[model samples]
Target: MAARGGGGMTASTRLAYQYVVLRCVPRVDREEFLNVGVVVYCQSADYLEVAWEVDRDRLAALDPGLDLDQVCEALTFVEGVCAGDERGGAAGAKPPGQRFGFLKAPRSTVLQPGPVHGGVTTDPARQLDHLLSKLVT
Candidate 1:
C-alpha cells in the first residue's frame, strides 16, 4: 500500500496501522503542515516522516543557523511519542505534544499534554487558548 508520508516504510507494522493526523501551519504550495510530534507519530510510523522533511526545508528557509542534526534532535519528541503509545489524554491536561510540540519534562515521567501545544507552560494561561485557537485553525 502507498505510504502516508509517501516514501520507504519503517520496519515496523505498528507504523502501518491507520492513524489520525491534525495538520497545522498550512504548507507553502500545498494545503497544510504537520508540526506536532504526537500527531505525526500517531498517524503512522512512516509518513516518510514528512514532518521531518518539512522541518528541514523550513529551517533552511528560516536560515536560523541550524544544522541538520540539530533539526533532527529537535524532533526527537516525535520518537518519544511513538514510544509512549497511549491514548492522548483528552478533555484536559495540557498541550498535546502528540500533535503540538514543547513540553516541560517531569521527574517521574514525560508529561503528555492535551491536543494543542503552548499553554501555561508557555505563556500566562489566559493567552494560551487565544494563541492556540489562532494557531490550530
Candidate 2:
C-alpha cells in the first residue's frame, strides 16, 4: 500500500506508499476530516515534512503487506490532494448541508507568491520563516 520516494513518481504510486505508511506510522493527527489518511514522514534538516497521508480507517480495516515500491505511490496521492486544494476548488466545493453545522470552514490552499516576491528558497527549512515574515509584511 505504501511506496518509498527517491525518484520521479506519478499519481499511480499512492497505493504502495499508503501500505508502507500504515505499517510503520503509529500515530497521526485524528481531530478533523483529515484523519481519513495516514501522515507518514521522516526527519529532514529541521522542519517536519509530510511524506504522505494514508487512508487510516481503511488501512486498519485491512492489512496491506510490505511492498517496497508502495511508499512512493501514496506520496503521489498526497501530492494530488495538495494540488487539488490549491486550485481554490475544495474549500468552496463543500456541500451546502455541511456548511451549516460548521461556523467557519477551513481555508483552502492559496499559494500566493511571497514578498521575497518571486523567490521562495529551495531550502525547506526556510519555509516557515519565509511564510511568517510574509504574513506580517
User: lDDT (CA) for every model shown?
Assistant: 0.31, 0.28
Query: Tens-digit lDDT track for model 2 on 1-137?
Result: 22233233333332111111112222223211222222221122211222333444444444344332453453443433322333224532333222211212222221111111122233432332343333322
TM-score for candidate 2, residues paired by index: 0.22
| Model 1 lDDT per residue over 39-118, tens place | 32222222212122234565445444435464344345443343332322331133333332333232221112234332
**Highest lDDT scorer:** 1
Q: Where is the poorest 10-residue window by lDDT in model 1?
A: 118-127
Output the TM-score of candidate 1: 0.28
Give lDDT: candidate 1, residue 32.
32
